[model samples]
Target: MRLPRQREAEVTPLHADAVRALIDAAAPRFRALYLLAASSGLRQGELFGLEVDCVDFLRREVTVRQQLIAPDDGEPYLGEPKTHESYRTVPLTKAVVDALAAHLEQFPADGVKIEDRTDPRKLHHRTARLLFLNQRREVGRRGAWSQVWGRSRRIANKALAATYDKAHAAWVRNGRTEGREPARVEVPDGASLHGMRHFYASLLIKHRENVKTVQKRLGHAKPSITLDTYTHLWPDEEDTTRAAVEAVLGDVPPLCPAKSA
Candidate 1:
């Protein structure tokens, strides 16, 4: 049986400059959210479900223990990750550590109550030291974070637009305005909070990390899944291959080193 083609995941990974712009535009409470996404490649739910205990600054790692599931009928609650592999830990960069630390300083953990899904009545209350909280001061919900993300994204996009306008003005002065206007490359389209994971994958591939390494970090069930998701992000191999071969072969000694005279 044939399955219908799935729509491609719209991905527009933010570059360093665009990311920095978003960071500059974001408030202190939300700064860490963006940084952790880019640095760790965690899913939105995993980030939302984080407890105060999940972060280990000393270890510079975050444990993906569970997720906060939002349902239509009842209040959101804690649940296991999408897969068993999704329960793995992810290492953090220095930037992510700093962001998280600062965010904690400003916004201390709150004792928000979420139901225990394992319970039959769904009446069990567990105290969650949620990272981001909603306007009701509860753990941040999907809509709340989505709103914040959208605002920051808009600010960054506007900055990109201003930059393009400035460039176009200069181009016109130089008598080169007849062609296509400068591109708004920094402006990403429809890339939501989840897109940060894609950006993180690109970063790993850009630094020449291996597929298996990315798989482990991303908590993919298998290597093929990692490849299927991010094969395009891997750098061109021809140049690196040539350089690798030449580095070793070029310095190799002749079949026999010349005998001393």
Candidate 2:
């Protein structure tokens, strides 16, 4: 049987305000989470699974440690990053630092002091002491205290759905959906938080970053994937290509040199 090849996923970048609006509509916890995911290019689970220790406010860096996984007939488990290199430290922007700092303040802690480090796994287990804890923590459920990992995914779809409905209503009122509320904007298909990662790569390429730097920032298995995937964003070659051909042919006409002389 011939199997159909899957099409490449379509990714659209959300404007800063649109992202802010989306997060604003969500609950407080999910709001902070959404901004982190959109800004940092983290996997959905990574956002919920993140610990305060993973963020380095002064250094402006965040590390990916463990992720949440769902298996049939079992509770969610925290596992290592997708690949060895997947465990990476990404540079943080001013917005991210401000958001995280505000979040930490909003959810005040007891006597715990926040640390500056990466290693998602180490931070995951250590996060048990954080002020923002899973609901299960309140009831004393085993294997559930630090498992707020599913929280973001639970709200991402709903928030996106609300955004869709708002745009739909605008279309009903106006002859054409224009301005910020377009008739439609492409959101990634199912299981495609990876598209957000692609969005980050696009942003880097648009800024004219070198391939090796982008690769290191993304923590890809190697530089090849960075070059192969984002090559389209790079500027096209110059007209020297045609000049090379003209130069080579200029030395000789259609006939041989002896015949021409």
Candidate 3:
């Protein structure tokens, strides 16, 4: 369904199983990347720019540090966030913590190395010493270690597209039809990596988490932005809230009363 431009959008929640399937299909690097984005509401650049140092397991927080910036050639560079709001800390979940831990084990602190079979030196010369590097390494060699903002964005976009395609195909194979026609595929309407952030926000609200808490988690410039965007997700709980409010407003009229005989 198309949303009105004037209306702020609420994040739509995906089924738990579907969410898991999506994450699983993105396996290896992309899977971990997907979890971080969905759970933390991190922008693509912010996620790609994360370093090992950014994770604070003891504190259960991930600090906002550098992000990937404009890339020259196939490499990406490190850069500061565009705005102050974009630079904010994120609280993590056990799933996120576990995903990160597993990612570290697979990738390690040493990083993915780049190699040039023809001229190893040339490959080393191109690699940028950024958080997300080419998943290949050239031993005893160093590259330029520039920034990788653009490259990271490209990678994320491609990965997201691939996921949608896979999901679409799976839907078709299951004999799901769109409308009255036998559907060839079922693609989500305008689903993007950012949609995952919306999913995260809605999840928090569903759990009765405070708007301010969601605001901080999403690093919005103001709490209003969080409230405006997600208020629709919550129903008017006036009847339920009345009892609680009456405790403080003792002078208030009774929310419900017995009928007169």
Candidate 4:
């Protein structure tokens, strides 16, 4: 039996506003992490593996040299980038940089101990100034962080839905269904933590960035991968060309003559 190949992962950028709302909904310790992920497009593990030095305020860049990984039997541990391209650096947004700066001042890193996932018996002690620490003053665990993010995500989505309902209340009261009032703007419940990376890609595509630029910014292994993932987001250039031709030369006769000519 020939089975159909599964499609690539679905991309739905939850967007910056929703990202900010989620950050706001999270506890103070997690605010910097959320902002960094949204702004820099870091994977959850990359964000988790961040050391204080990963950020360069003067250069306005953040490096993705490492990531945290958890195994089925062992504790979570930091490891090198999964791919060579994943070690690239990315520019950081001012808001995110500032938020991180503030976060560092408020919460300093105290070396957290974790069992290396590579070898359960071999424990690794992290001396780097990790950006995030839970209430126990240790690096975030995958299980615990997942639960935290799930809770905060719901809170942020509910808040957004409430705000949308209030804004459209008048229209609903009058039973109007047209215009922006009818538009639905609720947060995406389907989005996972990696959606922040997709959200960043969406913004870059919307701003008309080139494939190479997107690939580099996203740390994609190849331009083809980036294009394949985001080709749907690109505007229809062919349609635009047709429209341009129509606007400028619609009144003119066809360049081709009759069949006899």
Provide TM-scores for the models: 0.79, 0.61, 0.61, 0.82
Off by over 4 Å in 2: 1-18, 70-72, 109-195, 227-261
Put down candidate 1 lDDT per residue, 1-261, tens digits, no spaces: 999989576344777667767776676677788788878999988888888799999999999888888876667988878877888889898888878888888888857878755334554777888887765677666676778888888898788778888988987887985677676656376768777788888899899999999998888889999987888778676658778788889888669777899
Q: After best superposition, candidate 3 residue 228: deviation in angstroms?
A: 2.4
- How much does each candidate deviate from the true structure in C-alpha RMSD? 6.6, 6.7, 10.6, 4.6
CA shift of 226, model 4, Å: 1.3
Which stretches in model 4 have alpha-carbon errors above 4 Å? 1-4, 114-126, 172-179, 238-261
Residue-level lDDT for 9 in candidate 3: 49
lDDT of 2 at 135: 37
Across residues 1-261, which tens digit of lDDT does each residue of candidate 2 receive? 988987564444544443444466545644566666766777655654466687888999888775554445654445666667778888888887888788777764332233322454464323333424343332122344223323334455466667788877877689665655554432333423455566677778778888887887777788887776677676665769778988888677475457544
Cα lDDT over the full model 4: 0.78
Each candidate's number of clashing pairs is: 0, 1, 13, 0
In order, the Cα lDDT scores of the candidates are: 0.80, 0.59, 0.63, 0.78
Query: Which residue pairs come into collision in candidate 4?
Result: none
| Descending-TM-score candidate ranking | 4, 1, 3, 2
The residue-by-residue lDDT of candidate 4 on 131-214, one tens digit each, is: 777778876677787788888888888887777787689777777764656455445766667877888888888899899999
Best by lDDT: 1
